[model samples]
Target chain A: MENNNNIPIDDLTEEFVVNIGPQHPSTHGVLRLQATLDGETIKDLLPVLGYIHRGIEKMTESLGYKQSIYLTSRMDYLSAHINNQACSLAIEKGMQIEVPERAKAIRIIMAELQRLTSHELWWGSCAMDLGAVTPFFLAFRDRERILDIFEGNTGNRLTMNYITPGGVMFDVLPNFASSIKELLVKVKEHLKEYEELITGNVIFQHRLKGVGILPRELAISMGCTGPVARASGISCDVRKYHPYDGYDKLDFKEIVIDGCDSWARYKVRMEEMKQSIHIIEQLIHNIPEGEFRAKVKGVIKLPVGEYYQRVETARGELGVYIVSDGGNKPYRMKFRAASFSNLGALKPITVGAKIGDLMASMATIDLVIPDIDR
Target chain B: MKSLFQYLKEVFLGFYSLWTGLKLTLYYFTHPRKEIITEQYPENRTTTINIPERFAGEVILPHDENNKHKCTACTLCEMACPNGSIKIISVQEESEDGKKKRVLDKWIYNLGMCTFCGQCIDACPQDAIIMKNSFELSVYNRNDLVKTLNKPGSKLKEKE
Candidate 1:
């Protein structure tokens, strides 16, 4: 058979290529990975993207300031509230409108609650990716309670678009604090169950412990943020660093771990979930007795200039940049989505790891693809 | 001997961890009624449906029993909609006082393109449109989603 084959046998190497998902369960969204493998070891990994790009930034150019805020929620849907808040804060900065104290408190509370929900889903899905399915169910069970709180307070669940230019769309419901307190009670009790289900599992730990090690310099060069960067000894939590929406007054810890592995990323999020609960507890009791929304005038027009605002979403720092030419619609809008930058660090860390370990590393990075594509 | 001891330690810890997780699973399997959270959606729709009151399912123009709406055909909602999901068709008619008044002929909402962002409800100056709580909005045909919200012969409500 070797003699009968075509010429130039030396030209062909032992390595072959495998494509993992434009539609992969390993990827949280539509992210495709082209991996050159020698046996199970990935030699080169390239991420093929733009499967779900809707050109949200270009579309926002035609829409008014109020209408543009709604489009940001579509970018990173897991942290949709934070995305909306980033856009709203940018608009408020450009217009020079002071958001009311009550609105600021309400914004922080919703952002924290959403952070908890996003991390819970990440915890569940990360476990599910590693072959333990029960944790996903448990995770969803915890997440539904927070989503219910969101639905009752905001008109919608995912794309509420409740954060407007100067303030929030509606005031908190009477039961907002009571229901959150009840949710906190349940979440604290179930965290132990989460510990039992997935955190302590021997197989899960072995799979994640030393896989996909990203160094601190590499993480900084790649511009990685949120839990991914925090795992690698980067203290880049935007809430702690920049302190938007009165995060300065709140008591919480920024979680940073030096493991520089998938396990560290997972641990950072788990600790941050506790911190989120702490922030909510601080604000839930003392929502200021004032207007939930500042009076934003009709047809919001920013002075002809450039405006930029950054907020730490559950995934990472989301920077909203708007260029207005003294008009209702922005002349140009750009969303520096966190996932887009984090996805770049994947290939650098996963190049020599086995294919099975790729899932653990990728899951820990926690990409929501629309954010990347946008 | 050291290799054997390390091997035994790993095996023992693995089984212990799996067993602890399995115990919770066994407890759940024994008492599913207390622990079960999922609903079998389509089959038990009548029995277990619990949509929240503030859910923004679809945009609707609410009318009173007298068949009167509050729309003045101002077209603010049309302008406010990010994707042109709401279309207001207006016609200028000579009123009883001989003034040319633009009246609402049709308020069309395309649910297929809607993000359910509630911008229309927020932009409505007359409070004519409200997002209803009925969320089972799927249909067999896409064309069926384009609904005319204003009823035939519905007139504008007089100012209080």
Candidate 2:
């Protein structure tokens, strides 16, 4: 190795620094990674964030409780419904308002549909990251159906601020049941296609099988949640442990796998899509008839205390914490986004792996940059 | 001979997996119309696309044939807006009963900064403003986005 930068020849190491993205597609969003590489093997990795931070938490402190729910949707845009739901749950808990049963069922159905859409997008993008283009097209085809359903009812497709403080914004559409049943039938058939396309492919399996192994202990210590933790045999599903939004009334299994590798993470998400479908199927036909929103005061004021609410988003557990001084606006607002903690596990998992394996490990983590930065 | 047999078995299994993946793409490729997902935007604008009734495209002030509106100049929507997109200007007027009344002079809606969260519509007590399903709000100039929602010579409707 040539001695550059006037370093002592005897003390110089052969490792070279490689900067991967403030704009790379594989990072999923605007995230910069400083990777130290000795040839093809990674020695150390550091994730540099704050490219897409919009000061969402600080902004929420100035807005009223009703106005703050809309801002959470932009944090995890894929899991927009769940992000809004977490904020609303926090406000509802602070106020001690009992949400209507009909609204609870509707919230669960929307959250699960949002989960399916998010996972389908993740599957397509993750496959595309690994050099498979066909799955991307197929995945988006199915996701469009879900977006259309959201647009029809919520008035917006991506950032649907449908879940309010006490309950949902509006009642389910007249054909909500029939439309979801039709989509579920199509999604079930297409899931088999996903299995054949990528799950059984030998090339993909070789790339993912034991690439970046995250041990169960390390995952828990790192505060990982959702499919990433479940893949490592960590039973930290918020829906199961906490059971908010009528998730306790539903029958579904938390998907867990012990492989603790990129393949395990992929399999966990695939199985989660099925569980989401199962949950939706149980509640679709039995939507109760009642008012969608509870009659709370237009100007909602929280009690003078601290409140924390956590819900299982498509990524992981999203916790919304608010401190109120019995005011219209919150004194302090903070979000424990899953991508932030999940991003921490990156360096530990990818340190000794190849540069190519870095992409695979990141694909499995499914980092959405705004969620991390916020 | 045993090593060679093991190598051949591995090759056969790999090919089988590859074939399984290819079979799905071939099926979609053959059924083009059924599998194609995207809509032809602008080209099929009127025929294929239907903007849902609840979609929050742009804010509008619904007016009657008599050029009367329902806004009472309460500025509730302005207070509820997180981004200050809605600005209501009120002018005090003396009514025939010798009582002072606040009348809305202008309702300026800035389309640029709007997040379309529908908070303004929810906060409007008089049901004067609503989100219309006309999403084509693109304008050539930034000033064009700042629209005066109330009509030129309209008056507030009498309280029922």
Candidate 3:
């Protein structure tokens, strides 16, 4: 027989490699993390991506400006409305279209509601990732109310192509304000329940409090945005700095935490959910009664040039860039995915932490995998 | 003595936090009417399935009584569709004045590829089509997915 030579028992190294998932549930989508471990601590971690890349950007090149906006919703399905807003803003910018006041108010309301839904999903899944299953059910129970509200107005729950070039697809329903007020009350009450149930738990705190610390400089250098960066004391909320759609006029505070750890990320999202409610409360009662959508030409052809628009999605900043050849379809389209940039910081923050803390780190970053892959 | 005091305080604080979490769960367990949950899907369909009226499921070309439809076969829905799921096959016919006029024939819809973006309905100037809220659209045959939206022997309704 030929020599069956492998690494001899005497020469075995302490460092070993472990694959978390290209198809694991904690990942929330198809994301594979190859972690090199020395005993229990991760020596080095590398994220393997592109498992669910549906060629969304390339597909946008062939589709018209109107059709291409819907593809972004599929990219970050949790931030579907926000993704749609960014794409619409880019098109609206290119064509010099002025979105009506009523449309702007509706857009803001929908965007903030989607943000709450996204954060609720994150909160539930974050606790679930750390081994508690109850929060998942609790989170979805609250989320269904918001999705019901979305379905009533947008006609679809997840990938609502409701936000379009000049304005939204349709006007808000008659009971929109009353339903939102009712929802705000319910969600506010549930937030207190969530605080009691998971936020104060000793085990959860010990697992999260100082684990996977991401400092301010590292956060900025990594191009992190949204709650992930804010948790690290980096005030990079695009809403505050570069306010779009009616956010500038609204009275609200950006929830920035200086904890620089997983717990801070958790707290930041919780507070942000409250801020989202505050934003919604400001706009709901006073939605300008006027035309829902402006008169956009049947076919949208962006003038020959490059165009860009950025919006703060649930995870972070989503930038939509389009290059037009004076045609209905874009010559090239690029999505600056916040998850991809935020994913870069995962390895740096988690390399020296225990392998078990990796889940805590991943969950707090709040990555929606299709957002990263797209 | 001081070190012992610190250790005791840590244990007490830990237990207190854990109790708070458990307490919330206990409250929910005791009070049951407020808890929201879902029913079994197929079973609920016969009992209390309440799908929203605005839910987009499948496209249908609405036909009026007297076997008349509103489609002029403009093919705008075909152009509006991101996927080429809709095809308009029109035919020309001679009127009573013997003048040749183009008219609607077949509206072929591939439900398999439809994203239900509702762009097709929005593009129809005639308001000839609307999305029905019936979402139970599963069939054993693949060919059943491709629908001939316009009924056979239906004529286009002239504007009153």
Candidate 4:
């Protein structure tokens, strides 16, 4: 290292760069972080994305309305059901098809269950990121029950292309209500176990308490939503702001915390899981008896117009924008994914934090990288 | 005395927090049988696992005793597939009514590229193709995945 400045060769601490993933386990997917480090402190952080980009939006242009909905499931695999719902809702809005009450209730139930699973996975991974591995096992145990319920009802577990434009692809199974009730009871007990495992631990608290302090204004300006924004006191829950499906009918609280730290983000997701359970309980008993699918033509062609619909995924707001030119295929399709926007707030909060702190912050951000890349 | 008191307080607090965290894991470890969540793959294949009825594993055409399918060769599934997973091959033949009618020659579904979106099953107006529950689709060669849905010497089910 050469120092040109006359007065300060010894005083200047040379800053070096470190690359934290494109393949690191903590990244949760293929996200490369180019961090400028002065010792252990991150001076600057830049996230390099698109390692997993499959051109989902571009592919949607050629696909018909029904075919395009399936592509959204691949974008945010963690919240695939919600992603599919957003796309369907947008098409339904354009086509002006009223989804049946039963279908709406089922959609909300599925979305809430999907939310719980996503958060459960997040909780596990977040704990694992901070060096506690047991929570991963504990969280997955409960998450498997949710996946079982999803598989039993929707046929597939992860990429459930079950939600369609008119309604769900299939009706709920006969044991849907009982299975959910059983799951809700188990989950309630497990949430306490989770709290005991990590939330109240001094080590976990010390790592997360004041690390990555994101202010509400910064979160808002960065276009953060879901738990990340809500943690910062932004109150940006799309379910609360603009209710869709049967969310308007069911009652639930939007968990917001003013801590603006990693702890707050973690707590928000934890509380949101409880709220998801609450929403599911309210609707499971009363999934109105009616047609699961609304009447729609074989080939769905939306009139020439622009349509936009947004739904709250476990991560954040998933907005589906479709531009149709009086054709079966959309002329243009765009997805405003939550992870992509939340990834922007990472550098702002993580800068000046330690390398260990960066992992804590990133974990709390709860990024599903395909959602970012897509 | 003050310094001693501070050190003891910190020690007690730290141990208490650690104890709280370890308690749950200890309970899980002790009750291993009850807490075990993993499904033993391959070993427990026969008794434990029951694949759900609607599981979208592979697309198949159900044939009747007469070796006939319900496919009209409408190319609706081909159009519906997001990927070019479904390929419909048809031949124009003069029917008994002396009119040119397109008949199905081959309905090819490539399992390798199939996302199991159920769009093809939904779009099939004739209820010809459906997703089967057999999910063990792994094969030695990729060519094995390119399944021809229609049975050999199968004809379209005649209109009732």
Q: Candidates' lDDT values, in order?
A: 0.90, 0.92, 0.91, 0.90
Candidate 4: stretches off by over 4 Å = A1-12, B1-7
Chain A TM-score values, per prediction? 0.96, 0.96, 0.96, 0.97
Deviation in angstroms for A255 in model 2?
A: 0.8
TM-score per prediction, in order, is 0.96, 0.97, 0.97, 0.96
Model 4: what is its DockQ? 0.82
Task: By lDDT, rank the candidates, best first.
Answer: 2, 3, 1, 4
Model 2, residue A110: C-alpha shift (Å):
0.4
* lDDT tens digits by residue: candidate 4, B1-160: 9999998997888899899888877877788788666889888888998788888889999999999999999998898888899999999999788999999999898999998888888888889888899988899998999999898899999989
CAPRI tier for the interface of model 3:
medium
Best candidate (score: DockQ) = 2
Alpha-carbon shift of residue A228 in model 1 (angstroms): 0.8
- For A229-333, candidate 2 gives per-residue lDDT tens digits of 999998889999999988888899999999999999999999999999999999998998887888888899999999999999999999999999999999999
* Candidate 3 lDDT over residue span A1-374, tens digit each: 64547658445558889998987888888899999998888999989987998999999888898888778899999999999999999999999989999999999999999999999999999999999988888899879989998988888999999999889998888999999999899999999989988998888999999998999999999999989999999888899899999789989998888999999999999999999999999999899989989888878988999998899999999998889999888999999989989999999999888999999999999888898887
Worst 10-residue lDDT window, candidate 1 chain A? A4-13
In CAPRI terms, where does candidate 4 land?
A: high
